[model samples]
Target: MSNFLLQLSYLIGSITFIVGLKQLSSPDSARKGNLVAAFGMVLAIIGTILFHEHDGNKIGNIPWILGAMALGTVVGWMMAMKVKMTAMPQMVSFFNGMGGACAAIISIVEFNSHPDGAPGYLLVVFLGLIIGTVSFSGSIIAYGKLDDKIKDISSKALTYFNLLLLLAIFVVLGIAVASPEVFGHDVVWLLLGLSAAYGVLFVMPIGGADMPVVISLLNSFTGMAAAFGGFLYNNPVMLTGGILVGSAGTILTVLMCNAMNRSLLNVIIGSFGGGGASGKGADGEQVVKEISVTDTAILCAYAGKVTIVPGYGLAVAQAQHICHDLEKKLEDKGVEVSFAIHPVAGRMPGHMNVLLAEADVPYPKLVEMEDANPGMSSTDVVIVVGANDVVNPAAENDPSSPIYGMPVLKVWEAKNVIVMKRSMRAGYAGIENELFFHPKTKMLFGDAKDTLGKLVAEIKEL
Candidate 1:
């Protein structure tokens, strides 16, 4: 009876997971979706503890399980509440690494207890071990990169070395799969070391510009590792969740690669985005045009249509709320305001949208690149707030540039462009924004929040 009840519980959890994931498709329902899924997970945990039976022996141990879960819950809750919006990506990498570690440890323990397994089962365990270790180490490296703790390192030699290491890893995998009993226990430990090292090597050479894609790909790796765990344990909910995450992460990764105009194979090859400083101008110099907040305020207050483009700089300044405030202020004066959001804006997919949504900005105002480009010329004022690479005109004009083929906002098409920037420094791709030197472009120099505040105050006086 308990076995039957547990199976039924797993079924219910699986259905809830599917429904919850569907709800996550829309921003309005995302919170509810997360809560629903979390509830399903809680149910699964309780059912497993109370009713699970294996080898005709009921599973035991209540205190240890609840204690571990309580600790994790407390830690996770504190981190969620305390982590800054700017550090969200690092936090995501950290949490994803934890999931990968759990999967790897599960596989390791299972393998140690049941080394004499069927060839196919042994293959599943081996795959879980490799992918989980890779995900764990890769996620750590990604967090380091996102947090600026590790610098991008790339070279032709390093690229070749990585390829050789991958080849060696696959060779070892083949041996273990073919003959699981032939190798000593030490061989599995060696496999773990090699995979962990390879994960570091894999992410070390990827540039900051490619971090969103890398994070998505590593997430897929973690999902696949978890799926192997599900296979080992015959857990329906685990399998379903793993499949869902793996597929979603993979699709998101591909979309991110497309947004950046880079191929997945090329990204894995790790030869891009680590070159020397990008050229500033045709002859290494250009005149920078400045505009006063007062004058910029007048222009925005009177424009027929205005579009705001946001980037990582906005995130760093934690100024999305003020940007929304600026938008509302403009809209009240009869200007049609919209936000142009690049797919790869900030450090991850939907980053700009998430930030702006927190400010309670209406969904209709967030415009995508393709949709905003056509209407840009007719727009009167283009206020680029704390953005750099996504709006760089180099993407459209300079074929030799690193970000040449990437799609960028068509702010340059507007009558006048107001670029809010900290300095003349290049963007993440290390290329100078050709739009900055355009005749109609005016640079607003200062911190994004401070500059936007000034603009808001100036506009109010008008």
Candidate 2:
């Protein structure tokens, strides 16, 4: 009866997982999908704890596992609470690293348990080890650059170096795994080290603009690693999780490429950053006019209908809540407040929307690019927060910009535009934003969260 109940639970969980994934594909149902997925996870955890019975002879120690879980939970919860929105890209990279590490550890443990080398086990372990190593190291490098812990370095030669390192790791792994006894157990450590080094080298030379694509690609690697581990252990839940992550990551990569009007090959090879044809004028100075925050706020407060655009800067400022507060204040005064969202806004796709949603912003208040475009010309004010590449007018006007053909928010069409940014520096595409220099545009140069709060307070004065 207990066994039957466990099987039944697993069956129910699988169905929920499938349904949840389907629902997640649509924006309208995404929240429900998340809830369903959470429900499924809870069911899976209960079932596993109840059904898993390890004989004392086979599994002598459980304390370490329990302790590790507790430690991880505390760390994860703390990080989640403290991580800023601007640092979300780095946080995601870290998550990818953890996933890969988990897979790599599982592979090592399984290999150690079976020194005789089963063909199926060897293949799974090989795949998991490679993917996990690459994902872990690549993601760390990505995180470092995103967090500004390391400077951006773009080199054509780095690609070739990455290829060579990959080849070397594979060759060494093959040799070590083939003669584990002759090579001794130390070979595993060597293999792990080399593979990890290769992962770091693989991502080191990529520029900041390319980090998003790299992150997505690494996410795929993590998923593949998880899938390999699942096969090694014959765990259906793990397999499903891996496949889901892999598919979602792939789709996100494609979407990001589209956002830049580039292909995967262009992203991988051209290392293209999106910008106008003029790009960086002498000494990396983007040619855009700048203005003061006081003037920008006055412009927004006086506007009839306002559209707010959120980006990583808003997240970093922890200003989504402030934005919400300002929006409510505007609405109270008979202003039509709506948010314009680019599909690929922020460091990752839908990143800005996720931040806004987390702040409990109304779903109806958020509008997509297609829906928002027509309204831009009629909009009295468009407030851009820490947004760069997505709102560039060069994409529409400049033939020479790398992102010339990409669709962007038509903020320039609005009667008045206020952009809240930190500096005159160009976005990831390393190209000047023509919109910044527009006659109707004003720059509110400051921290996003603080500026939004100031605007909210200033609105009270109105």
Among the numbered candidates, top TM-score falls to 1
For every candidate, C-alpha RMSD to the true structure in Å: 1.6, 3.6
Question: Local distance difference test, per candidate?
Answer: 0.87, 0.79
Candidate 2 Cα deviation (angstroms), residue 116? 4.1
Off by over 4 Å in 1: 277-282
lDDT, residue 165, model 1: 90
Task: Give me the overall lDDT of model 1.
Answer: 0.87
lDDT of 2 by residue, 361-419 (tens): 99889999989999999999999988888898878887877777888899999988889
TM-score of each predicted structure versus truth: 0.96, 0.85
Tens digits of lDDT, candidate 1, 1-462: 898889888888888889898999887898899989888888887889988888987776778888898999999999989998888999999999999888888889988998877878878888899999999999999999888899888888888998899888888888887876566566578788889999999999987568899899999989899889889989998898888889989998999999989898878895566666564455756787999999999999999999999999999899998998899889889899999999988888888988998889999999999999999999899988778888887787778677888898889999999999888887766667788889999999999999999999888888
Q: List the residue pairs that clash in candidate 2.
A: 86-316, 276-401, 277-400, 277-401
Clashing pairs in 1: none
Clashes of each: 0, 4
